[model samples]
Target: MYDIRKLVQEIDKEHYLNELEAKSKKSKKDIQQKMDKINKQIEVLKTRKKKFINMLADEKIKHDEYLEMVEDNNNELAQLVEKKNEMLSMLESEQVIDNIDKLKQELLQFLNFNELTPAILHHPINRIDVKEGGTRVINYRFAAPTFE
Candidate 1:
């Protein structure tokens, strides 16, 4: 008889790896898009600041109002810069990659076990549905495998 535990573990690991790859790609892309948006906003604020300076030099606006505008723009620019730096730091860190690698290694170790313990099953499986004629459907905790 086939070892059901081994079969389930194999299936779950394959599904998990695939899901992780897709999710990581999406997350990186999202972060990159946000960074781009922040950069654009920074550029816009810088342009506005320059225009304010030109208006002040030409004496088109009162000095006090120009100073107030410059202060507001500086505050907003500082916040955006801080946010961009944080995002860049996150991109530079290997934490996400390391965590995924660690999980993969742990799952690989499971291959050494001959039988699935309750802990192993519970970690990956959400529920099991039994159908007529002894067929069973497993719902994984993460996501179901896409056969296609």
Candidate 2:
């Protein structure tokens, strides 16, 4: 059965996370920081957005003022939201995705390790080389043979 792909997947998933935690504190720290930052930015944008809506409902506001305020708030919110998404995408890379898949396969290989651990014995291409100079190829059974 095919297994190399599975082995890589398992290593990436079950092993890679733990390994990453040990290997790169900065990456982990950066992720936590980004998450907190994104959340705070989102709240701020929501509040600003709500205020813009409230302004529209105010009876005293002129049409030009309403449009200008709405446009400004929209621009700010869009910028903040875009920054959050960019950070998230940066943190999530193709390597990590591939590793997760590889880890799954490795886990499966580990579970059925007894079979994988066993060595395979195949007959050698060259059976024996004589010192003076005859070259012989191996035949699994002794009874076989014609000289090439």
Candidate 3:
């Protein structure tokens, strides 16, 4: 059996840290972009809602129609708000980004003992596939590095 821990031990800490930080930054930017888009959509809906209210007040739209439009707008707004909150919560989470040193240490310890503990294995190895001709394919939990 291949000692999977050796792979972790061989990683260059600085390179791994750089890759992790880059990934984190990209993820944060993507989430922020989505949130900004949602905010813009919400603003547009609010404007439409305001217009509907004005129309109703001026006796241009019937009461039932106004109520239905308002209800629809409220439901849509609620959904967008919920999605925005979820994105915000994700952006606020720093657990993965803050634990690089700890993770490195743990990986080193696991490698030193050459033990395949469930926690250690599951933390880094996503899966292993056995192929024909005794070939085994390994997949990592994080983005795999490309060797030059």
Candidate 4:
């Protein structure tokens, strides 16, 4: 049998999770915006390339001029597509920092909880210290592990 008490000895706050969420939201937003911009540029380039074809068919421009414009459009499209791919890769990498969810899922495997409700448990109290002037310090057994 799985011991939930040992599995969940302490509830720790995911400090980096919050910070990463904020950063990733902004990063993802920024990357999405850039991708959208690239898509629009690609569409514009396609439209321009089509216009060049129409112009060539209509004999409105010389063959050399039309070919040059089409070549330029292709070059710009290639560059934009490359940049877009880089942005997509960055977005994928940004999602790699998901340890908090992994930890949550692991804990959830042993416990079923939807929300926090009041509970009375004395096992969590490790000890109570009485000092001078009747001052008391209550030490809890379940606490976030401290790091040096």
The C-alpha lDDT values of all candidates are 0.72, 0.55, 0.77, 0.70
Q: Write the per-residue lDDT of candidate 2 for residues 1-148, one digit (tens) a residue.
A: 3333343443556555566545445665687698788789778867876776687788557778878887887787788778877767767742443355444544454455544333322321223345545764444211211112
Tell me which residue pairs clash in candidate 4: none
Candidate 4 structure quality by residue, lDDT tens digits, 47-107? 9999999999999999999989988998999999999999989988666345446654555
Best prediction by TM-score: 3
Write model 3 residue lDDT over 1-148, tens digit each, in one string.
Answer: 2444544644546676677678778878999999999999999999999999999999999999999999999999999999999999988873456665665666666566566687865766778899999898878655333433
List candidate 1 segments past 4 Å from native.
1-12, 93-148
- The sequence of per-residue lDDT tens digits that candidate 1 reaches over residues 1-148 is 1334444465457666676567666767877898999999999999999999999999999999999999999999999999999888877652443465554455456555789787865765668899999999877544323323
Which pairs of residues clash in candidate 1, taking residues 3 or more apart in a chain or in different chains?
A: none
| Cα-based TM-score, every candidate | 0.59, 0.45, 0.62, 0.59
- For candidate 4, give the lDDT of residue 19: 62
Q: State residue 130's C-alpha deviation in candidate 2, in Å.
A: 41
Which ranges in model 2 have alpha carbons more than 4 Å from their true place? 1-20, 94-148
lDDT for model 1 comes to: 0.72
